[model samples]
Target: MNKKLIIGMILGAILGIFCILGARLRLPDHASFSYLLSFWYNRVILGVIIGLLPSLKSLKLSLLRGLLVGVFVSFAFYSATGFLDLMGFFAGFVYGVIIEFVLFKLNQMEKL
Candidate 1:
C-alpha cells in the first residue's frame, strides 16, 4: 500500500481505539451498546480528514471515488475493533459519504 493509505489506516485505528476507550470511561455503566457505538461513529470524521489530506495535491479523483476510498478505509479500521460489528461499519460508510460531499462543495467554492 502507498504511504498515504498506510498512514490513514494507522491514524484511523489509533483514533478509533481512543474514541472507544473514552466512551467506555465516560458513559454510565448501563449504557447501551448502541450508545457506545456512537463514539465509534464520530471517528469517521477523522477518517474523512485523512482521506482528504492525500488528495489535496490533486483533485483528479471524482467525488464518488473519494467517498468510496474513505468508506473503505473507515471499514478497515473499524474491523480492527472487537466491539464494532456490521452496523457500525455501515454507519462509518455513511459518515464517509457525508464528509466527502461536504469536502466537494468546499473545494468547488474555493475554485470560484
Candidate 2:
C-alpha cells in the first residue's frame, strides 16, 4: 500500500481505539464493550472523510472507489476498536457511501 493509505489506516485505527478507551473511561459502569464497539463501528463517517483526502485534487466519484476507501476505513476502525471486529465494517461501508454522495453534491456545487 502507498504511504498515504498506510498512514491513514494507522491514524484511523488509533483514533478508533482512543475513542473507545475514552468512552469507556468516561462512561465507566454504563459502558459495555459491545455498545462501545457498535458506537465506534458506526463512525465510518470519519473513515470516509479520511479517504476523501487524496481525492480532493481530482474529485472523481465512483462506487468502486468509495467501497475501496470504505474498506480501508473499516479496517482501520476495526483494528482500533478490537471489541467488535466486523461490526464497524458494515457501518463504515454505509457511512462511506453516504459521505461520498454528499461530497459529490458539494463538489458539483463548487463548480457552479
lDDT of 1 by residue, 1-112 (tens): 5444444444555556665665566544733687556555556445535544644534545355556765666666556555445555554555455444545455566631
Task: Please state the error at residue 52 of candidate 2 in Å.
Answer: 4.5
Per residue, candidate 2 scores C-alpha lDDT tens digits across 11-101 of 4454566557766765677558786765565453464355446445344554445566777666765675554545446645655555555
Clashing pairs in 1: none
State the C-alpha lDDT per candidate. 0.53, 0.54
Model 2 spans > 4 angstroms off: 1-61, 83-85
How much is 50 displaced in model 1, in angstroms?
4.8
Query: What is candidate 1's TM-score against the reference?
Result: 0.45
